[model samples]
Target: MTTGQRIAAKRRELDLSQEGLGEALGVSRQSIYKWESDSSLPDVDKLVALSRLFHVSVGWLLGVEEDQEEHISNDLSPAQLKLVEEILSRYQQSSQLTAEQQERVSELVEQKVRESRSPRHRRLRYGAACLALLLVLLAGRSLFARLKELDRQYTDLANSVGNITYSVNSQIGSITSRVEEILKSQNSLVADYATNIQSADLASNTVTFSVRVVPKTYTEGLEILLHADTGDGLVDVPAVPGPGQEFSGQITCPLTDSITLSAVLVDQGTRQTQLLGNYSSLYGSSLPAVGISLLESALLNIPRGEDGLFHVRENYGFLTGLSASVSAVNEDIGQSQVKQVQLGLFRNRALLFWLEPCSRPDNHHGFEKAEQWFHLPSVELDLQEGDELVFAALVTDQYGRQIVTPSLPASRVEGDEITWFSTSFDFPSEPDGWGLAG
Candidate 1:
């Protein structure tokens, strides 16, 4: 059934009149009618609100499944229930998951289940803990030692949380349906992929790049090659999602003066090399369209992909081609202005990053723009994990200085994935501004 028909059906199921649902949504009765009659479609926010009001999954609302009724099991344990809710919520927000992504998410859920099934581990650990306590009691160790151990454990837990956040940040990409085409450079054929820098650890002397490749045809023994500008030797790693699958991998190469990166296809049965493409990082961002030296950061959304990573779906979008050299602007002092920002997702090293001119609002103060959610120009992205949002501004306090205003994180309402970075503020008490853009 269409979303409209399902809306009408669910409304009847809830015994709510058109006016009643409208009142709940804070919209007029006409809006509800228009939605039901298929004259118009509700945006992502409305879809989220409708799901909560009706107590239905976003998948059902989006017609991902034929049956709309929810059959939640009551016998689930607390952790299991929470895990199921999270997975289901992710599904509701993102229906554009690929088969590989679906499988990865399923594996995560299964991993949780497996962890839960290991009751003996907890019991054995408890027994070991009791034995250790008894030993400590007999060994005449000071209580101070135990306290210090506990403090060390606490610190470890805090570090673990940090690691989790970093892991989550590193593995986000969104999938968007787009016009299926290929980018043919001189030596390679490019399909769809996402390029974001991974956090480097001081312990490892290697730099890793996140490569997500979705190939339409089959190829064997795929290998990625990395070359430094210093004319060093080649670093080759095997490609992931090899065949009949989506490619997503954290490709690690020797950290030399590593500047140029490329990929090649090798036949599994026979060794032959076909060049993918070579990509170079744009260390400095040049925004000719906005006329501001764009500051880039990877602190965007961790939009989950079908493969349980964060990625965007299309190749050619706003991120392609610099349109103008002059950054155009219409300024005003009467009130603050929220400039239009252009964003891009590159596959390899991209240098140019820019944000529109805007004021940074107080984090502990209030919301930025009146409308918290803005639809990304790329509609094909089914937000499974996250898309790290990069906002550039025309502020020229100092050219090339990084200005990353702390904005709210992305969230899901009903069926739509809503992000919360705004360029305006409503706080009147604190009459102050940060960043050199304004």
Candidate 2:
């Protein structure tokens, strides 16, 4: 049944008039009428109050559960049951009862049951019975007041515990952050010394070392040296002081054979040596390797073929943006330093645009690797059947030597036949390079 029908049924079972329920709920009689008719619903507080007054669960009144009445009659004595039946009958005869009258009848039924079960009350006269009922009522009121106070204290205790827990968690988080910062600072202090191989020239068979002592006060009576293993025995080369906390040393050796080099600091008084950094001549090649490749273009909706080329139709409008990745690696001891990378786009053997110094190596003083992605702006191109698009990168090392990567090409497609374009091209040597105007 609907919520309204359930409310009306429960109200009738208790023989309560609409005005009586409204008065108990502190609402107008029209409100009860509207609720019973389902034209409006009671607020949450009113629903709770109605549930308590009718001695029914709120879930049942809202139709969320099946209506199940509390069976208080099972424990009732014969005389008490008869008294309840008579009371219900008298209310039905009158067709209605006020809220106050209903409450009094319910209390009278409970009092009757309690008095019948009590041995002492069973022998009491009417006057003693009346006095006992008054005492019971007062005791019940005190018990309810105590329960309410206990509930308030429990709420306060729970709130206090929650606040304390929050404060403790906040303090723990702050302490954890401070501890992490302290550990980081200690680790950095432990690694206060650094050393690196600045350059190794195979032609001159010379290797240069760079050392940095972070704590300048600890440099006294300390001699920096470069130890080299040239397939014979260890050779020690003393380092000369440079500006600030820097030191440099160069040693000429036969680098043709794979050699190992290490930088160390020696204690002049105790003759104890501490190793700093080590390098092998075979880490990377002397010449830098550069590459360029076209990444996929999501906007164009074109698929790449097995031959590694983007297949485009003849007279296709190239309005979508394109991007290419350029990478260069030269980790050799001497010429490993990559100064700059230049990228260029070509259409049919002519330069479309060239970006000078499109990318540079990281600023680690001696980094030897670089990679960058160049995003081409959206442009309109009338691509013909024999047209080809190429991307290339020019990598320059520290010694002014430059190397160009092979062209990465995209071909034009007509019907089922694919026309491949030439991947060979020369870079423009103009000072300003090339642009779309060409």
Candidate 3:
């Protein structure tokens, strides 16, 4: 028979459906169908796997040999063949033997032929054949009963083997499913450990942070840190553990400039930090309500120090050209409102001079704009160490009501030309005192 026909026969013998066989071979039902229809052949590895699954040799599945019985009989000796014939004749004489019994007798003869070919039986082949014929004659009916019992025992053993094989395959499938479940559970746990920022509040110069964590046990030996990038440098603050899985902390810094916040977890054992999340815009406090929109100066060309502060060297003296522009006032105030803008300079919180820029005609229809340029060629103020210089703007409306913008501070280095001029707001302790442009 062809290989496909043989495969079909073996599958039927094992009481396996096409789907069952496909599952055993790790292939789709369509693949099994094609293989059995001879439309496609299994690959070399698949052929080997099939041979092992079916408990058959690869050569037999490939149709390399004829029927198993014929193959066995081809190697039998003449004496062995004669003995098989005699036994068949005796069985045929029994009137009670049915057609099915006759077929079984032939199979028995083939089994005996294979056994007799063993080297131990080769020397007594003819003698054993004669003795077998005599016994068959003497114990005719009794001998037939014994042979039938043997066949029953063989059938029971085959059934037991099939049961054992099925049990093993079931156990293997159960183990595989359990392993997958464990892996899925582990992945779910990892996902639960993700930290999230619950809320961030900015009050004055302090920013308070609130965060949520999963699994209260995870808080043990875990340190949470809040990092703020203040354009100049990074400031790190540790969060104190609160009730349950919550953590909170606060940092004091100017909130005017845009700050980048990052949440991190530090392991107490290894002291290594793991980033949890990041916030680019916090509290929307990056810019003041009304202040310098832009400031340009030649001093900005100096390189910044490692601490993110500009360090002006001695060679570049003070009095470098500077330009400052004031952003439009509140949208409600129209340009038609009478107004005068003055730039005030303060040293050590004391007013030094008020320089007013020449106001251009209000050509723009919406709001008023003010700009001032300073080139202090001969003027030099001996700025001492630790001295702070601040710039403020005074806006007076037609009603004589004056409003002062927030102050910008710059500190002088001990021996350097200038240290740093920060764009952040530094409101004076007594706001009313600084509001007057005397």
TM-score of each: 0.21, 0.22, 0.23
Global Cα lDDT for candidate 3: 0.45
Q: Scored by Cα lDDT, where does model 1 land?
A: 0.39
Better of 2 and 3 by lDDT: 2
RMSD in angstroms, candidate 3?
Answer: 34.6
In candidate 2 the C-alpha lDDT for residue 217 amounts to 40
Pairs of residues clashing in candidate 3: 256-286
The predicted structure with the larger TM-score, 2 or 3, is: 3
Count of clashes, each model: 41, 0, 1
Q: On residues 24-76, what C-alpha lDDT tens digit does candidate 1 reach at each position?
A: 99987656755654435666567667866877645566656554453221233
Lowest summed lDDT window (length 10), candidate 3? 314-323
Error of 2 at 122 (Å): 99
lDDT of each: 0.39, 0.46, 0.45
**In candidate 3, how many Å is residue 27 off?**
60
Candidate with the larger lDDT of 1 and 2: 2
RMSD of each: 25.1, 30.2, 34.6
